[model samples]
Target: MTGATYDALVIGSGPNGLVAANLLADAGWSVLVLEAQPDAGGAVRSSHELADGFVHDTFSAFYPFARASPVMLGLDLERHGLTWSHPPAVQGHPFPDGSWALLHRDRGITADLAERAHPGDGEAWLRLCADWDAIGPALIDALLTPFPPVRGGLGVLTRLRHVGGVDFVRTLLSPALTMLDGRLGGEALRTLVAGNAGHADIPLDAAGSGMLGLLLTMMGQTVGFPAPQGGAGELSTAMVRRLESLGGEVRCDAEVVAVETHRGRATGVRLRSGERYAARRAVVADVGVEALYRHLLDPSDVPARVVRGLDRFEMDPATVKVDWALDGPIPWASAPEHAPGTLHLAASRAEMAGATAQVASGYVPAHPFMLAGQMTTADPTRSPAGTEAVWAYTHVPQQTRGDAAASGPGGTGGTVGGDWGPDDRERFADRMQARFEELAPGFGSLVRARRVLGPRELEQRNANLVGGAVGAGTSQLHQMLLFRPVPGQWGRAETGVAGLYLGSAAAHPGGGVHGAPGSNAARAALAHARVSALTALPRSVGRSVRGTLGRGTAGGGAS
Candidate 1:
């Protein structure tokens, strides 16, 4: 009820938070975003920490999910200073046998490459691409839409009716490892398929996970792996700028410690600084599910069922990312195309599986699958000319069992401890670097400077990446789609509390900078606001009528 009041108070000025704020403000509502970090964008930030003039994307780099995202593309980010850089080839997976599987942006060229590898593999690629065309649009719609996905789901069903219902459902939920195993003859092609899906914490054999890679790969094929011209942070800058232009304000370093509520509804928020802001319409939380329910709100206000479900809400695999200000482009045995686009260092399907299994067992994998990006190749502005700013990240154990067997490959037979200290960081980072060295000799010498961030460091940078689980939470079978974040609040942004919404990666459509969680949260808040108004209309009218009648009765008595 003061100057500080806003129509909506969004906690955490991440991409999702800004999306909600921008949408709310664009709809003629006052919105304010509170960020814990000094800057916005959450995980999608870039910095020159590696070395001066060498801009390294601190967290996420590739934008397959973001680029093809309906929410992102529809937002007109280009007009807000977000420029995309695409490499000649979208992605390449090279093997030790002087061969690689290159996914070209051009379908014909990709098909030709596939045909050269295996007889019918080329046709399989075409058929897969065609299958994508059939349901891809509908699938994207279904993914971005709020849960239940009536229209988008039905659209996909209609498109795939000829594919047969049983097989259709099977394909939708099939594991990527299973889908591409025998169909794509060569290990190179198979690795490409499964490796793409492995981008998430979900294992290769996990059902409902095969769809992840298929979706990303198809999206990459259509639109190359585009990143911001300057760095990943530029995308965030554009979104924040767009939000500000819409009259919404983002306050960085505003740590939201609690969600102030009255009568079972979110009333406002209290920052750690002890500052408070009233929410006239809603309080949308772009924080994690655990953080929102366990810490942000009072225990009594949170639903008991939600608290219990939070316990079961599996955290995704932990990631260890290393960025280096390299002297020059990576010298790969496979030559130029090896380091182009977003590259996966894992060689075979078996290799990917073993690494994921190690992660599953809470063991630091000796041979972890790594995803490295050649920033200079995509956008030269990321570093000085002739030099490459490269980054590689791989999943590690969230907690070690303290068993000696958990030590990374070829190690003594015991746990090295779970904490990510300087030793742990350097040791694992060396293993990852050595992996690159195997694929591209002399990879270690190219580094002029490097920054290594394990789970703890990543969590310290962004709390939303709890335990360094980057995909927000596990992309597991029981946690996908409607079951994501939580079972009840799937597909929508509103949380258990009325007038409160979860807008972070922990919400429906889970993880990635695609903006589905934020957009959907905004839409949900708007929908709830409309419903509240409609429901209160008759009550408000009745109250007015009674007041008038009471006044009339009082006047008559006076007379």
Candidate 2:
């Protein structure tokens, strides 16, 4: 290996990759990052091409987890030119009738709004809020840390022990409908709460769906949905700046082709263009698990059990995103009190559940739940004066089996294409626009320009986002914890192969812009490098083991 090569090579320039590079560089290791795209920030980026002076988030818009992440906080992103802005109200759900339920940052105000909608809902909101407030931090800790959550798991257990884990788990077991029914009375209020819970691919009736509502609500109250100051890309820009400041280098347009190994140990990587970069310390992959195991490493290099575990990989629902340059603020029947936060366009809990169920069953919902955001409302720089940059996204079944005709003219039903071709993109966008028109009349007229990206487009842009599954993988219970990626692979970011580590959303503490996986991987690489210095002693011990337990067992155990 050449000494000119870096000590650490991060194979993706996503948030996780940047974080890992920063950590390694900060620890005095020469780090390099290779990005397949022309720029950094895999999914966290913004562009003004949708309309002049109108900046729109290319992908993820809201940053609930980003604000609360300890890793993000520790970086003091604000100092790195990151600023957060929130709307007056966190979110709102508008109904056909002249009624709207809003989520205010203030619990009291939100409770009062719930009360106005339904008498006892105020108390229920307060109780749920309080319960979440107690466990929210612990949950974040458990999530942001590596899996097994040994420390975080212990903390959660300690907190829930007195309350009883069974009871706590049971409390979160009820479907969103059941929970909302027990808590709120009005249809609008129920829709407001349950719609937020349906952000993931999980059906509202799914076992762990309730936690989505609780966690998102608590996070919204705590940090509000915020966007970067200049644009979504600014967040990524800040990360890149920090990594560079720490002596890290990022090479864009460099796609990793394979993980090079020597003597059953990962040694470096080969780029698609045939360029090779050796890792003196570690090779951190910020790509999807499927890409990592199936494409990058040789099958013989990966354990057979790990390969079988890939079958259990459950992806979140596919998403259809629409970005529009609005002539003005959305024309709601009853003007919402706050600058538009996230708008939920559903009326009842059952309606929202049915919509989610429809999507889960490979059918487009007649009344799809839409999450609309006015980006410029939160950050004025997003659009020209008197105009708003808005976006809406909804999840659909991954591989819906049907024809476009079956779904009618403007439906999503078709042989699930690998890429959301231009035709399907336009159709999905039109369907969403029609939905908005029904919920808020004349909404279509306000659009100055429109752009759409379906699951396939999203995946093409960012290989890390396989199948356009944004939440990395399914955030459900079975795929979470020790079972994340695979069991017995917790704590250490490295796989069984030396010098190779999983540092993407596919790893534990999955998804969001948290950067925990990258940080964790960097720490593991540093430890491994330190341990390498004492290899002489280990070699002597290895000789004794070989003499005692025959050559087969001795070299086999080491391997």
Candidate 3:
């Protein structure tokens, strides 16, 4: 492997890396993807280690973004043996009163449910869905494309006026709860939106929260939050298989320790085992922003602006995820007509916001707002018959200050240690379980086994999940779009090094299983190669002219 060379060397085997590799391979480039982990997928991997028969996604599960992404869709992964499965309902939020707020793929059904929950809300839901239908594709295209999305922007601009133009923009800029309040009447509908917004580390009252909330819920309504039919790993496996079929290669257990650069340009990468592989065209990195800049590349290779920007770079909050293998289906006190694959554990918009605020303020929320998944409900292949595989995750501060859930749940006090040690993780898991038990009376009895992955454990599994900051970096407005990874880069894949590109979640559009970053990076590399090829003739001609003149001068001197 040390003497090997390829047209492109992708420095991770996550979705983004694989996407980039596949695209390059399609372009007839010799692509090689090097993965540090024993397995290929980064956060996209799954395992059955938690229990005997239940399959669990180690990191990310549902992929509404992937379904809606042009890059993923264009891959035709279904042909490569990847299939998606969705629950009867896309998502659901249960209330203390036994009523539920559910988002179904069918707009009419979702609207009817909303209307039943609150008068006029049904109409409002339809209007919202209709508006999204008008602008959503262009909006998504604009988002997934590189900065200054000319074509996608034009598409969005053409449709903006019909969607209330500036007014719609203002609505997106407003806080999520505020937007929901103005648009819909019922708490149930608002709760559904707010809960989706809470998926990010953004505060419910923040400006960007509305856009995220709307984007996710609208995506659910359109595509549904679908997962791989067998497991999340299957998504990655299909990508790898597709890439391999395209004459690409993926090397596992190949940790890239340093990016080899020459004269301010990336030339290749060096592994931890002292092996080096060269990249003839470009080296695409699918690692974290900080890890790439601060660790992989040398200081001289990185731009001063990017290095200085790192000082202000903030990561999203750490997370604690709990996975459970259940003996039977989750015993909801009042199940919905259509079972939902995803569930939100929050009482209301206010409760969700308060919990988010608590985490932001360096304290664990007593009643944490959690996003949970019922894997078996979505795909029965995840577990044995009559059983379920479930997981829930919530945010925690990078550093612990105190526990705010003193008397909240699981009979634990507010003084659980903040270090996330064994004791701390157990206590927090108990708290999360208690939250689940609140909505489902017999939840504990159904749990056959459980696994708690704290920040450290998560980071250990995937270095890109720095401190368990799943989104790679904060999705806040301060660090998004032009400001993501750094301000000078203009949200492009180029890392300011001549032949290196950032294809990770840290790039523009932040996180999610979408392959935009990878596609963008691969396209950028291809564009650069085309430009280089186009200019080669002139450069060679000039060199020939110079050589002829030099030879003439030497001949005259000899005479």
Candidate 4:
């Protein structure tokens, strides 16, 4: 208290850390946040230098999760200079034949469009949307809250039980391609749904990939893929403003090198610059488990079993992103109804599946499945007059060394360039542009200026985005739920470490701009501090299961 030491110290000024700091500060505890970058938002910041009067979102353009996240809604960012703009239609998928499938905010209109493209698809679309409407809210709640989703999940189960669990699981587990094949047979309709599913790291053939398609499309129909007014960074700016309003302080250019310990409890942190800051309450880390357990903490300080378990951690596939300042809008033949929404360019569900397979083999597909957004169409503020800001991103396999000879069978028969450098990115970008041109004619002429970001660039910008994984880690079955980061330890943020906690996307409920991990970590730390403070008093304090200390801390350096 003498030197301005606070009750809690949060490492990393990403959404999670900012949310945690805000929560603790609201509870009357002084909070300090240390960030490595000059800015606060990890993957949510924006810049305007791409063009005059054009603000481009550096990463993460759409915010379906942000809109649906209970934490975000509760924060009421709108009142804090954050407004959302949802285009009439949420997304579209263009095909080689000039026709396209679009997802409109109005379900009936979208169904009509699907029906026009493929007979009987209207009913199938309606049925899918209806089923999603019944459980979508509950599912969103279940996903955003702490794992095992004690409350929201119960609500979901109750609803699902009334409808029958077998049917529920079957509906949720249906493959995107299978569903599209059975319902929407047209190539365009199939591409639309498959494109939404591919937004996550999961392949079209992955078991849970169907959920991404269904949930995102359904959410688009229900809420739309809205962007924060002005720019995506405005969302983070609002969170930062709110945190500062609550008396929380953020220190940029401060990277935590290690978490200091005493008597097996996290005592404080040492910055990369050799400055030390102690937390009387807790040290919440808004980074991936790899960095938290394998890099920051000493392996000797952590349990041997924990270190061994860390070896099993898997990262999502890396990505290649391209941003273009266009002289004019993409010229599509008989433009889709919702040109303002996202444009997915894949001919068929089979084609998308093949593309993922190709990427898994370390080869860039001849027809890569890409999700392209016309930011100027969605939010006019993103670009200048008579111009457009186009953003596109696609994924590739991780850990592919620059030697095709070293790659095993089923691998792409070409060496992946070192770290997906600028030259490689430009080549990939050209291929993508050509692919887009094939789907949407005159697409190439619109580009006035362009910039590309690859896996290495993404990692260098934000450590949380390891291997250019925007989601922090893969959303595969093995890496989800309590198994996230590691199994057997789910609820509390503590990693068996005394005061250290995992409050990043690598934790439960995984990535997006949601702040559930941070909120959960703050609550846990607050509870622990309260119990510890009470115990020090003269009177005896009754202990409860929630407040009871578990096993020893699982300490280790982060990956």
Candidate 5:
């Protein structure tokens, strides 16, 4: 606990923490990962919470981001016992008329299906997918790296050309609905895009929302929605296995209470049990910006600009997730065969628009836009034979304080209190199930067991999911890249403190199971260390002289 030193310290065992630890360990650094949970994986872990043998991811499930993650890929988790599964279909948007707009791994088939629904849309889909294919790699490189994504950003511009670049810029700024309008023929295609975009707390009419749906849809088409063969926890197991192999250690049930710093430089961390670990190089925190600034570090050590930025550090919408151990698959009225991919079930585009508006204004969407994942459909290892591990999550206001005026479901005018008690959660969950029942008849009958996790419950599960804002923070214009967590170049780790780095989702490349934040943090830490080492020439010389004097006196230290 005392007088011990490690080359690097990671404050959480979430994906970000594990990734940062792995990266540092790869660099031949002695790293220690501390986790408050009895296990690792943060929100990305899975468990048999729903039923016996039916594995359900406790929080973050889908692996679209992880599938494309450079960090995950470089780590080669697959070689460490992580197997992936991809369903035939990537996504589906069904309607009441027993028709589905599905996206497949095969671009031609997906476009063809779209055309059948809306003839011209088939060509449009292919064009869009092709555009993504061309610039997608560059976009990923630009997005997943540190601020000032020069190469990736330029690659996109060069591919799009002048007029296309302007158009793409407009799309990034336009509301998702606006972008979908007149572009696609069928309601199914429109719903498909909206579903992808609305996965966030953004309103359909909200500016800067169009790109979200477009990017996700395209990613689904290209990389696809793949999950681990066993369960999400397997990803964690693989990561830990890899980390340990690099001489990195992860201590579960080790809660880091406060980061101990001296002279504006992080020295180490103190555990809740009063055990302290001294860090020789740097400390990385994989917690929210709010928690990091308000709790962990001493307020006196904080910079004023960061304090001001905290006011603008917005959290995304809260969520209420439901997981079920179904007796069988959901008996969908349309495209029951699409049980493998993600399903979007909302009444209609207009209804979804109204619902999202309500959520943006801090009220729950009465008919919440739901993203349902058929886990067993994609990976049979998730549940017992003939049964399904079904899970769905939808956005809601981060309303938890007290009652406020709110229009419930579909943004209907009504009062909605801010408080979210067990009763409130249950009521909303029941309504969501009922909504699903409308799309898939007998859905309730297949549910052998169910678990509901609301905003508070999510926070209890993982502090990084602060206020149940799962994606770490909002992806709005003001909270993005160069301005994330805090203003200036401060977003990429190097939290105002010299040796403390913010490796959490609140940092750059916010949220998802992607480990870019951690990757960036590791790079920053290494850079800082190199800079410090160069600056410590005189100090090192003094240390060498002091060691020479003490060599013989410190017996065991002398050869």
Candidate 6:
């Protein structure tokens, strides 16, 4: 059966796709969003499979980016039954000495904690915050918007002189470790910043790492890492609700096998079920770049340069995530003053760097650094009272060559094979659990149940997560901005095919829950539609003029 034609057809109902559909609908365009999965929201989903009463976010949990993104905020999701919830603190890093590095929502409390750790660090922390206060908003605006960020970049430049100008730029460009070493002597502040940098696959010692680390840290300081009041799915639900309210439609379990095109333009898509849906104006894809070019579109439709660019495209790394339904809160030897929603587990800075290096070198680190979330703590509605819904994820090599834990840094001669089979997965989960056990004694005892999702499982659940590489692609300097997805494109949402746009994480201003990629694509579609209509006006008039002249000549001859 053939599906009804819409002004635009959006592939994938992830946050990006939903955002695009909402924008198109706002412009009075008929938009339909298709999702291959059984449910909508993509990675922004949740389930109670681990425990009857516990709600666990399937993929991404804490959303500091969503709280800070103007694109997300402008949607007014709160009106669509979405409420933001923040834990007592934003992020925490527990040390072996029982000292904790916690980022509190209040800058004063965070500074006080830093001061307690190091004499001069309190003032240093505030100084950095003040500088961020001066330019962070503008910088973030520049980051979350389309490339060249003229308005936001100008906002940044106008405020630069007040915030160390060239030195500020240097600080943003510096390596994460180098920035921390130069600015603060306290391990607490350093740990917080460095651990946040781990959220990305960038190495701590790399050039572009500082900006990401600082961006997240500063965001936590200001907006805080918030979660939807119920679950991460609520965020997606809110987006879908908003889109539906705007007259957009979403259909799940509809797998698109191919994007049908003709005359170098996207026309519609064909589903595996032999159904064809026409898109009158545009087709926005919220899938990975590789999936769009390789699987969806025909080879003849893809530009040769893009085909070549795909060869150089590098995925970040594979991942392994574990979820637990804890009977009670994590019992810490020395509890943080304010419980944090998110925590970073690593013995030290060196160990954290070692783990990332191991992954980059195609080995699974023995002492993997983990980014964990206390979902119940972040949003009390996630689970029953007095219980916790916790989850953690660590990066691994896309194709494991060895296990570094057996002999790598901080390794205690543990042997876990690189195959990532059931045995290997269990062993690695045990290894990660041990890290928590170190900080919270008898932490394993509180687990009511546990579930693990490795690379294979992740890919099975979400095709965009190819090999469990969550960021869509590497967030390195070499693949960002104009170089993103491919060079010569200059971070545009438009694919080479007219009326097609890449609205996924693989596009510019990559990753995070920010809606820039989708918004960019939607705007591009609208712009092109206008241009096409305007360009067609003269031709339409010329034909009409010729017809009128012919009719007049015939009438005169007959007379």
The alpha-carbon deviation from the true structure for residue 359 of candidate 3, after best TM-score superposition, in angstroms, is: 0.6
**Global lDDT of model 4:** 0.77
Off by over 4 Å in 1: 1-3, 162-165, 336-339, 402-416, 538-559
Better of 2 and 6 by TM-score: 6
Best by lDDT: 3
The list of candidate 3 runs beyond 4 A from truth reads 407-410, 539-559
* Candidate 5 per-residue lDDT over residues 142-253, each given as its tens digit: 7887776656677777876632677766766778887867667777777888778888766677786787888788788888988888888988899999999999999999
TM-score of each: 0.93, 0.90, 0.95, 0.91, 0.92, 0.95
| Candidate 1, 469-548: lDDT as tens digits | 99788888688777878776654566778889888999888887788888878887876775555557688785775565
RMSD for all candidates, in order, please: 6.8, 5.0, 6.5, 4.5, 6.5, 6.9
Q: Candidate 2's residue-wise lDDT over 425-462, tens digit each? A: 77667777876776667788999999888887888888
User: lDDT for every model?
Assistant: 0.81, 0.77, 0.89, 0.77, 0.80, 0.89
Q: After aligning candidate 2 to the native by TM-score, how far in Å is the CA of 15 from where it should be?
A: 1.4
For candidate 2, the per-residue lDDT at 15 reads: 88
The true-versus-predicted C-alpha distance at residue 258 of model 5, in Å, is: 0.7
Candidate 4 TM-score to native: 0.91
Q: Among all windows of ten consecutive residues in candidate 3, which has the lowest summed lDDT?
A: 550-559
Q: How close is candidate 1 to the true structure, as a TM-score?
A: 0.93
Residue-level lDDT tens digits of model 4 in 1-559: 1235778899998889888888888899888999999988888888876767777888788888777777777888777889898766789876666777788888888888878877888887787777777778888887777666767777788778654477667757877666556556566556677788888767778778887787887778888899888887888899889888888888999888898889889888888788888888799999988888878898777766567767887788788888888888776666776665577777777778887777677665656678888888898888878888888888777865332323322223333464577666776777667766766677778877777888888888888888888887888878887787777675347688887788898887787777888877877787677556656755534344324543221221100
